[model samples]
Target: MWAKRYLSLDASRPAWAYALDAIIANHTTKSAKAARPRTKINVFLQDWNANTTTRSGLPVYARNLLNTAKKHNLSLGAIKMDKNLKRKLPLWYHLGADKHLKKLNNTTISDCLREKHGVTTIASLQRALRGEGGCDAPIYGQESVRDNCTCTTCQDLRGRGCKHPRRCRQAADRLLHFILPKWNPEDATPGDGLTLTRRRKRRNQDMLETSEGDFVFDPSVTEKGELSEAFRVFVEEDTTRHPPALRPARGRVVHQGKPPVQLKTSSTVFNALRAWKSAQEQMVSAQLAQDKSATLKKR
Candidate 1:
């Protein structure tokens, strides 16, 4: 619960997702069938200083909440703010640095060129950075070795200033692939959920014109999740638009593998949880039966 407390917007998700991350994270972590006791979640919605224009100040809402809590055997309590926090609790462990906190200087640019583009020398860097249609403009940025070659492609590329004219479109393609900024999962703004992603070359790319490298090495980061979420929203929306299309959604069985842990350990944990739940239910039923008998006797 403590690890999940800060799942609310921290620093990793897009601004468009305000607290959806937290909401989804909570839903997912609890969805797993487990018998462990979980901390009860309470909505503390006392707008101490609510807007004056709102109907019936805020006390009425509090009273309504108390009535609802009582009806459901829920505890309703309030805590007063003792002191101001210097910084937000969630931001204390926010992912990625603030944009203004760090600036890219020549060092960073050079490092990025060297590591990602394999430009060892300043000369190669200038040629590599020529971008799109300059001399020797092949964006084989993923090459591990950086030796010059006289292959037909390389020579044909060098001989002609810009290769697009002589069908040296690969050069143009290199620029086309990287011209648009790639989506870094690290840049996922923390918006209230447990965010995670892995890096793969040529994974996050989009281009105005089609090209060879215009494919995502991984789609789970953006495509699968985005499309799945969009699909869910589409289905969840009011069917007033197309009420006839509504029907019970059939569920699909994905995978049925055991947890990726030692089989013995997993079995032990499962058995313990099962036993605990059995005992808990038994005790509750016995207590209820005894209470009922006592009430009958009293009557």
Candidate 2:
């Protein structure tokens, strides 16, 4: 009966109009799960897809209406066939009516459908429903690359050097001043608190004197020569500053039966003293040999 009435409708009517009439008729008499009038419309459309074995046989008008409802942001329920109704009407009509009624809210479905179609407005909504390619508006506008560049002047100048070189130089100078203070020559002294300027001046004077051979030293050989000089100076200074180690005696006074005296000194100091004594002995031996030769000549 529903199929006959559906077929009887004028084919000339707009697809949405026919589909809307079918939805209203099916929902008004029946207890659709969707309690609200608006909700029932969405539920009926969803059921059309669910109950039919093949959506291919659905009238073109019905298909277009379903598409329109989807564009309008309708939520659809799963369609189920009523066995009793299935025997009487075409499978399409029975299936269209019996599916589980799904709830549809206008705002939510509209937003969702809008996103799906990649459009935002209702006129575009209508065009999408009609299967027309509406205006091509990107879902999101392109992000600006220029906004994120760090060097403001460089970015503004593009390929050119900074237009405000003075300002840039001043900023750089200020930054350097903050990081490193200017050296004050007045703060320098001869003790331990020489300013960088004084130290530099002394270094320059030393270099000039060294170049003129005042110290009779080569800066290149200073490292090794300085080590040798330091050793000699340390030994001479130590010997001059400290008295020689005294030997330990067995008795307070000399006695015929007294044991031999023993001398003690640190190994390091002892070795240094031994080396100095050996050098003095070599000098005396060489002088004696020279005297012997001279005496022989006189004879």
Candidate 3:
């Protein structure tokens, strides 16, 4: 019965429209799980795909809506009513919803979709499916071979480097990647930034090595000074490049029953590595201190 109505939908309606209609039908029929918005969306996508020749995967479309709604505390009803979001949401749902939705309010999917489809619209979607090539279709507008576009909106997007919102929230991560010097975590530190990269077990080669990536530090955890010091250590390790003047003194480390080890005077690679480790530890400590103070204030 639902399939017949779905098939009867005017071919001109947008993809999201089809999704919305199916959801409403389920509610009217008192379908099990219709009370839960997420479940309704999931069931609607499933029924739509099974009945239609062109099937959008159930998981893909469901994830796109659920994850985005989660970030903004949006009800599924709100998304259905917002035409601007309706325009953006389908493309995100169609191509790369899961990747972009992992981060709260991430727009990587939307921006990249624009980069590929050149500002999608309902008409564009129909044209593309029919091989008519809408908006950014090569026969229509233009394509960006260089990952950029010439339109005013795209020009602004490119100028901002097309970085997603998640990148901006990652301070310690950016610091580890050597993209910036100062990162101030907005909240308590999560943990040490070091990641175990390689573990080698050979004759007397028991040493375990670690490395750092953007995920190593949660930006919500550190302060600006700590991030700067970590980035500074990254610059210091490059002996081929001249060292910046007035380097910070390396703290001493003492192993069980072993004499103290001085970080700065150690082998060039080891010196930088130790400095980075020290900075990571300090940043974590600073984060903990901040969290404690905030807790006290609340009390």
User: Which structure among the candidates has the greatest lDDT?
Assistant: 2
lDDT of 1: 0.30
Model 3 weakest 10-residue run by lDDT: 179-188
Residue 106 displacement (Å), model 2: 4.6
| Error at 113, model 2, angstroms | 7.7
Q: Model 1 over residues 75-98: C-alpha lDDT tens digits?
A: 111111101110111111111123
Lowest-lDDT window of 10 residues in candidate 2?
180-189
Tens-digit lDDT track for model 3 on 1-299? 22323223235435765665554434332223323232223332222122211243334444454334333432222100112222222321221122223231124443433444343332333333222321241322233123333545444544555543222223212222221111111112223333234331231133223332222322221212211111111111122122123223357733343357754444888888899999999999999999999999999
Better of 1 and 3 by lDDT: 3
Greater TM-score among 1 and 2 belongs to 2
Candidate 2, lDDT over the whole model: 0.34
Candidate 2 residue-wise lDDT, 1-299, digit = tens: 22223323234334655665544434332334233333232223223232221344545555554455444433311111122211222111111221211212233432333334322222333333332332222222353223223444334432343333223323222222221011111111112121245555566688787774233222221111111121121123233222233334445744443358988689999899999999999999999999999999999
TM-score to true structure, per model:
0.18, 0.18, 0.19
Give the clash count for each candidate.
Answer: 13, 3, 2
Pull out the clashing pairs in model 3. Answer: 185-222, 187-220
Candidate number with the higher TM-score (1 or 3): 3
Clashing pairs in 2: 79-99, 80-99, 188-195
**Which runs in model 3 stand beyond 4 Å of their true positions?**
11-107, 110-153, 156-299
